[model samples]
Target chain A: MDKRAIGVFDSGLGGLTAVRRLHALMPQENIIYFGDTGRVPYGTRGRDIITKYARQDVAFLRQFDLKSIIIACNTVSAIALDLLSKENDIPIIGTVEPACRRAMTMTQTGRVGVIGTAATIRSGAYEKYLHKKDGTLDLFTQACPLFVPLVENGRVHRGDVVIETVVKEYLTPLKDAGVDTLILGCTHYPLLEEVIGDFMGPDVTLIDSGAEAANLASTQFDPNEGTGTTQYFVSDDPQGFNQLAELFLQEKVDVGAELVDISRY
Target chain B: MDKRAIGVFDSGLGGLTAVRRLHALMPQENIIYFGDTGRVPYGTRGRDIITKYARQDVAFLRQFDLKSIIIACNTVSAIALDLLSKENDIPIIGTVEPACRRAMTMTQTGRVGVIGTAATIRSGAYEKYLHKKDGTLDLFTQACPLFVPLVENGRVHRGDVVIETVVKEYLTPLKDAGVDTLILGCTHYPLLEEVIGDFMGPDVTLIDSGAEAANLASTQFDPNEGTGTTQYFVSDDPQGFNQLAELFLQEKVDVGAELVDISRY
Candidate 1:
């Protein structure tokens, strides 16, 4: 029974969705999280920068005795998962494939909508993965660039005009496309599930990509006694971490976090 | 008498506002601009991260024959101007002091409002500069964290409800405070000039900080015929550069740009 901690990270706090999922699925495993809050919205950046940041993030997490690493950021998962997975021997899980699989399984109409960051949508990772599995699947993709900042700023409530308006602007086309299954391709997108759900109606099944990946990772491990503290490390100052983490994790986590100079890694 | 290009850099395209001002004020001199679009919104990062990025940006520009450098980003101007100034013998200008001087001179009620990123507001650089200049001046500072993202997403038009709603949310208190002068502290702030001006009314003189810095730089140089090509370099791929630059530059210019891996510097 290997009890090494799981290393999960994202460009920012949005990865806490995956962390929350992991916490639920594998309550016994130690979880270490690194959020690159200092330099976020990796969605808009080019592939090289995203790859570089992903390397740095994984390297930082590699400092721990991690059995595995999770690319909780959809942008990284879409663009640099292969390069990251090859970096070490331990299994590396990305939030894309497991999510695509879930969407394919759930969609009876074979129509799937994927909404994510610009980079995630542009990478065509979800579309390629889904179409490869089932050639007849019809795929729709949209890049909701403003959603991350909106959710990060906590303007994500269903009735909020700003979030609702922005959500409608990005999601209307996908809704009209008659897609029965929608993938919340980015972890941050799930935070706006209420607004997106209210706009898309209950007919569309939304896939939480990060949680799906977390579930996949949980199924890989045997349950073990909880050991070691749930440690959090962030590239930015820890002052703003807990409040945002709580929002994404949906739980009151121990507020102690260490600040790291991630670039050195 | 200097003929070398003026090196101006921002974490992102927001500094193009300063470039526009420089281009207008000194059409003869070559203006070299570097936007670290890959790792942008430096305002939200910690002082050390911002400092490292500013140093990298300055180092990248230092590769060129630059007579002077302008810290067009208010976050960097507020936090790292002194450190950067110490780096080289060349005259370095930040967007803070000149704007503070202009705001102080323009204020009739001894009351001024400063709005910028959280870093800019938290740094208290503008307030300190103005207060140091005039002890009796009443200064109000607000941190509009969402403004950068909102403006970046091209929602700065005066009549748009999104821009108006956001502007009202941020500027109402400053308006109620009866400040006669408001500083558009960040370069991005000037992009939303029309929306901000409409919300604050024409009575409040808005200080365009980056423009003031550019104007100050222009005044320092004797008019020289246009030199070697006005080149642009960005950390991100040039595919998305020209479009956004045109948004902030406000003029049509030749868009040939070289992509640089800025982290190397």
Candidate 2:
């Protein structure tokens, strides 16, 4: 029964979705979230830069006496999770394994589609993970690079032409491949869930990796006594944080975010 | 007649447009272009972070014996140019002033439109510059925050629905406003010049700020004896640099890029 806050970090506002799910799952657990909003969309960057940013993000979180850490970014999880986990003393969890497990249970057919940033799909982390669980599973992978931009710009609506067109452009491949389960590999993908779901139709199960990771964290590390309060920190756009979160969470959240220079960490 | 290279930098590939024009305008002048591709899309972050990044970007370029510096990024031009100029001994040129002077000459209806990153438009840099040029001029400004991502993802070509839809979404307001001249305030916007021109029609002259800034630099600094060569550097994506440059330039480019860690500066 630990009292230290759970540290959760993402490249940007995507991790707030994870925080939402985690908050719902364990109302008594204290949470600290770090969103590197200044240097986001880690999906489009090189592995070396992603690894460097991921380390700095974790280092910032480590400033707190954290009970555990969650890497809500698929790019970080794919590129640097193993290295981060190995270095950190406490339990360090990434979105990949939990999301892979969730997809396995949700898929009736062996066919599964993974959509994420370029690095995530390029790394073959999801394919590698699921194959070890069951070699017979069929996987189709696509890197929806523009999805983060679409979501970041608040184009995550059903009827918006840009979002709809981009979603169709990316998901049509997975849809045509006839995969019944789709993994929203990047945390940002969940924000565009409605547009993606509408395009993919009702039969396809969309696995929210960040949410799944939050659920996994809820099961593993128990800081049994906590205040249940959530503190948010971002590298930039502190004023826009609450508005962005409310856009994703669908509620008026009065939580104020403190600006932290993650680069200094 | 300085022999030193003219240093040009952007948050990302956008600055390469300035470099392209500079290379064309002054073939004998040595040029150093730095694109912070590792942490691109500086348009959305807060002013403090942008200032920090802009300083670091200039600092990286300052490592070379530059005769002059060009801030090809409208966000940096809008937010950090004055401060950067004051801090450095070399003459500093930003996209805003040169583009403003060009737009003043092109506007037949005394109506001009400016489109760039959110930070650029929000900075009101263009508005202030144009107003100071001619107070009676009718000005319309729009923040096309998604333009960089669209360009970065290689969506600059015509007939692509995504780019068309986005262009229409951003430009329709300016078109309806009856703008006679449009400023491509961000470097990334010039890559989508064809689609933008197609949408805005023939009469509306589109001003490429990066190109104009490059032209301004060409006039100011001679750099008399160079090898007629250009060297490229990026914080990330060394492999993708030439390919991206080619897409924007419409030529087969073979210049290999060297990677630099900009944050270290």
Name the best candidate (by lDDT). 2
- Cα lDDT tens digits for candidate 2, B169-260: 98999999999999999999988989999999999999999999999988897546778777889999899876788875556888788999
What is candidate 1's lDDT per residue for A38-108, written digit by digit as tens? 77879988898899999999999998998899999899999999988777899999999999989988999
Question: lDDT of all predictions, in order shown?
Answer: 0.88, 0.89
Q: Tell me the chain A TM-score of model 2.
A: 0.97
Error of 1 at A226 (Å): 3.0
Q: Candidate 2's residue-wise lDDT over A61-115, tens digit each?
A: 9999998999988889988988998999999899999999999998999899999
Best by DockQ: 2
Q: CAPRI verdict on model 1?
A: medium
TM-score list, all predictions: 0.97, 0.98
